[model samples]
Target: MVTRRWWQKLYHRSGSSTAAAASTRTISPIMYEFEHLYQMAMEEIGYAIDSQTSSYYAYDLEDAQAAVQACIQLYNQLPITDKWNPWAEALQQLQTRLDALPLPIN
Candidate 1:
């Protein structure tokens, strides 16, 4: 089950100061949390991409696939925005690379 994040809890809490600050501030807590999570997801995606492309070392396909799946999950949890465009592109590229790999017959 997906649990609510700290920002969600904060946003939902009664009589919260963040609600007021969010309205007046240019960068709301929600945006801050989104950016933080986006950065983390991007980092994980980058690592998987890099490891797969590097010529010096062998990387685990399962691990890279897992990382991509995790990033996709995080992306799905976040709100809709053009900010996610890059992530969508990166995910596509990573998926393409993964798809090129030969599958083992069961």
Candidate 2:
């Protein structure tokens, strides 16, 4: 008889019901909340980037700035140990786009 590793039970293999049950385990409430907020921030960032790239006459720099600020706020709210460091790259890209926009002369 072959002994299975503990981690292997979480994956679907050999049509085992145990794998399905393990995989369906509920996520922690904190993680769920973080995921929801992160998605909203990403959508806002995506919209801002799209607006900046398009040739629309009514592009609002303030909206883009707000979107980046929202994401930063979200990042700051997370605990240090729970931080998703990879997300910093997305923030950096959005900042680059905002910086590239020309300032309006008053």
Scored by TM-score, the top model is 2
Candidate 1: deviation at residue 105, Å? 9.0
- Candidate 1 regions exceeding 4 Å error are 1-59, 104-106
1-91 per-residue lDDT for model 2 (tens digits): 0112211321233556434644686755454445544454455445555665555412345544554565567667777666665766766
Residue-level error in angstroms, candidate 2, position 23: 12
Clashes (candidate 1): 0
lDDT of each: 0.50, 0.51
Q: What would the TM-scores of all predictions be? A: 0.41, 0.47
Q: Which stretches of candidate 2 lie over 4 Å from their true place?
A: 1-59, 104-106
Q: State candidate 2's TM-score.
A: 0.47
